[model samples]
Target: MIFHGMTVRQKALDLLDSGANGADVARRLNVPRGTVSYWLHMERSKRNICPGTRTPSCHRCDGVGLAGADYVYLLGLYLGDGHISQPTQHRVPSMMITLDDCWPGIQDEAGAAIHKVFPDNATCRVRKPGCRNIKVYSKHLLCLFPQHGPRRKHEREIALEVWQQELVDANPWPFVRGLVHSDGCRIINWTTRMVGGVRKRYEYPRYWFTNVSDDIRQLYTDTLDKLGIKWTHCTRAGKEYNISVARRASVALMDAHVGPKY
Candidate 1:
């Protein structure tokens, strides 16, 4: 009647396999319900009966609706600086976004967005030399982020699927906000002018998004076009890798929605 260690665990699992619930198995074996539940979970894991496989948690695979706004934001973060990796030791793939340590608010927002997009997964923060990497593990990362591939984002072509495009269209500001938070910045450029025989300084505020990938830059500019935000390509050091939003109206619109990274 009394079991110990693995013996009790095996007995609990056997009861569970026989269609008895955790509570019933615990009552019959005189073990705590929590302990019985733990045993069941471990047994399921051992048999590879994970929740991802059993219940279909992935929105894409299960045909369930995604957290659209959060997903679009995360997609921007992913396109800008996120990386997805599947380590040999891990059962699932992880998506990580590296953000500067100075911007804890942006870090928090990225973490919150990841959590909201994949509510069932766990997220962690890893600190590097001068930045923090926000990471989340999920089996369906590739399913959600179809742009993930073997090559670096800049080295490969990046395009959105029809569903993803629809989501971005529906929530343009959040998408822009995500990209800005990841790889864009609002800065001030100044010039000197003579007014009334006196030298005066004038400041102009603008938003700049710099990315080496032509496709990604095109995507950013295309989204801006939809929002009626005018952007110009800026060539730095003979390379055109920056998109500048300097028009008064466009800058005002960006300030109202995206603003500077906090």
Candidate 2:
């Protein structure tokens, strides 16, 4: 059986019992180092457990496999705009992805994707004064997204593990679709050009993905290359990379794979 799925304190004690360093647990769980220290002290002193504390009801079955469309899509979403966080004083371990509220279809898609990965867990959505978010509570989330840690995506060396690379290579469209949905935009480009001695205006569709993480950007572009989709990248003023797919043929392929969000 899994050694986790207990409350935060229990998980901390278990990790320590398993010989994991307190600092490593803190970083992995995105908790303050002091909090880990406190848990260790409390466990050592054999203090009375909190009255209401209980182990979570775990419906987890076999380990989640990574070779599925849902997993790849979720992976792209995480690489783009998703985040996982440790439990707070009033929360459970959760993973959340917030998308622009304007794209209701994309919001639904994100929720569906989350459900696809964690079929046993219930996914919830929030819509109000800000973007819409799809969130779910599960300690097993970290098992699926081990790349998770403290810090922004750009600050970390984000690279797919070997199994993930193989899965992504096998089926890349859904992964690309998820990343574009999260961090890219599809728009119509308009420009004027001299046509037969007269100025003419024409409109063309394009897709642009912008991110500060060079590794993620490279990963995206490399995936596009593997799919034979043409793209180009340029650096913006503030070091942000803009990867664009605007060529007629490239846009056609994107239309088939990464359509507009909403």
Candidate 3:
């Protein structure tokens, strides 16, 4: 049985080396496509065929254009809750964004955005205790996300580059939506009101974005100001760490574009 397996594997590799795809090799060798794919991957690793050798599809290095809306949305997510890490010296770095498991729709959106930004790369989801991490590996992540550095995002200075600002300016709603999806929320507050000499209970909806990074909050408010959306700083636990959009007009605009996260 072992000799037969070795012969089949060798045949499969030979077929693959002759310029046939995994599907074609599997069909010809009467093996499962997944088996052929595994063999191909193992063979590449053995030969040290690193993915980093491939020409990076980077906007900075290759002068390639980004999917503007997707990039801006991803930028927002990264600034809010995303992280980039290099696992080892040899492997490329990966970018991860954690979203609550209850919001499968938001998870799908985040995955789609990552795929659009790095179409040539593969993305996977890693499940944690209460959230799912959508991640993609690439060598050019630093070039794409210049905010990555040695310290935590809130502890370091965060600012957008000129080109990134241009993209965000052109597509503000998506950027806001991304940020809200990550670290912001829409809630309804209730209060008592007197109407016609009678007491009544009324509820109003508002949007709130909480971020520890002052620069990140500034970026959010600056975008809001450009859109003519009124916002104020809300003090929480004796710290002004929240941006509130309680005005009816601003809430309506947020509802129209970004609604609550799914």
Candidate 4:
């Protein structure tokens, strides 16, 4: 019996009963062939009766209570700049979100959000040539993010489920925060004006969310509107659109819910 491992003993026994060879079971479970062979000859009922290693958080694999601030926020990040891939003949299902290497703060927040959503599974950070990646494996994500199919975000229609919509309705800040932090920026805007016959420079703060996907941009703006955080949208170079929150009170409002990443 393989102890302290993720392999489901009972499931392995069932696979063996289904006429799969020990090697095949081992390959599927990513375990040693001897481990599969040992479990195949043992007591399936006794092993199942012992206890399950699954924790409360792993329940998300089956699509339980997956609606909340964390869930919505993760969804936002995914929609903004995340990718999900199905298992190949030799791989497991995985989801990845890559961020610019320069932004360690955003990377840390993304890692924490992924861990919060999939607490049962372990997530790892990988460094690519110019970006950092947060990757995790979970087949259950296929059910949660149905919009995770072919093509880029702009080429796809991004829509949320009724439950997800309700979650955003109740807690829109985290959702917007995730979207903005992933694909937006907060910076100072300076302008020159004439005051008392002298030219003076003034500075103000603004939040800008830019995305290539119109549907996603709409979703981002819709959520901002829901929270009553006033913003303006304008077309940027290429197919991108920029949504700006520059009003004094509006900037203050966003600052409360979503501050600088670092």
What's the lDDT for all of these models?
0.88, 0.79, 0.89, 0.78
The TM-score of predicted model 2 comes to 0.73
Candidate 3 per-residue lDDT, tens place, 38-137, comes to 7776776676553522244888888877999999999999999899997687478899999998789999999999989898788999999999999998
lDDT for 20 (candidate 1) = 82
lDDT of 1 by residue, 1-262 (tens): 5446887788888877777887888889889887887676666677665433324467777786688999999999999989999767887788899999989999999999998887766789998999999998887899999999888899998999998999999999999999999889999999999999999999999899999989899889999999999999999999999999999999999999999888
Tens-place lDDT per residue, model 4, 108-194, is 888888888776678998889988888877756776677888888789788887867888898899889889878988899999999
Better of 1 and 2 by lDDT: 1
- Native-vs-model 1 lDDT? 0.88
RMSD of 4: 7.4
Task: List candidate 3 stretches off by more than 4 Å.
Answer: 1-20, 23-55, 87-90
- What would the TM-scores of all predictions be? 0.84, 0.73, 0.83, 0.77
Question: Candidate 3, clashing residue pairs?
Answer: none
Q: Is candidate 2 or candidate 3 better by TM-score?
A: 3
Question: Which stretches in model 2 have alpha-carbon errors above 4 Å?
Answer: 1-61, 64-67, 90-92, 238-240
Q: After superposition on all CA atoms, how large is the RMSD of candidate 1? A: 4.5
**What is the full ranking by TM-score, best candidate first?**
1, 3, 4, 2
Off by over 4 Å in 4: 1-63, 238-240
Q: What is the TM-score of candidate 4?
A: 0.77
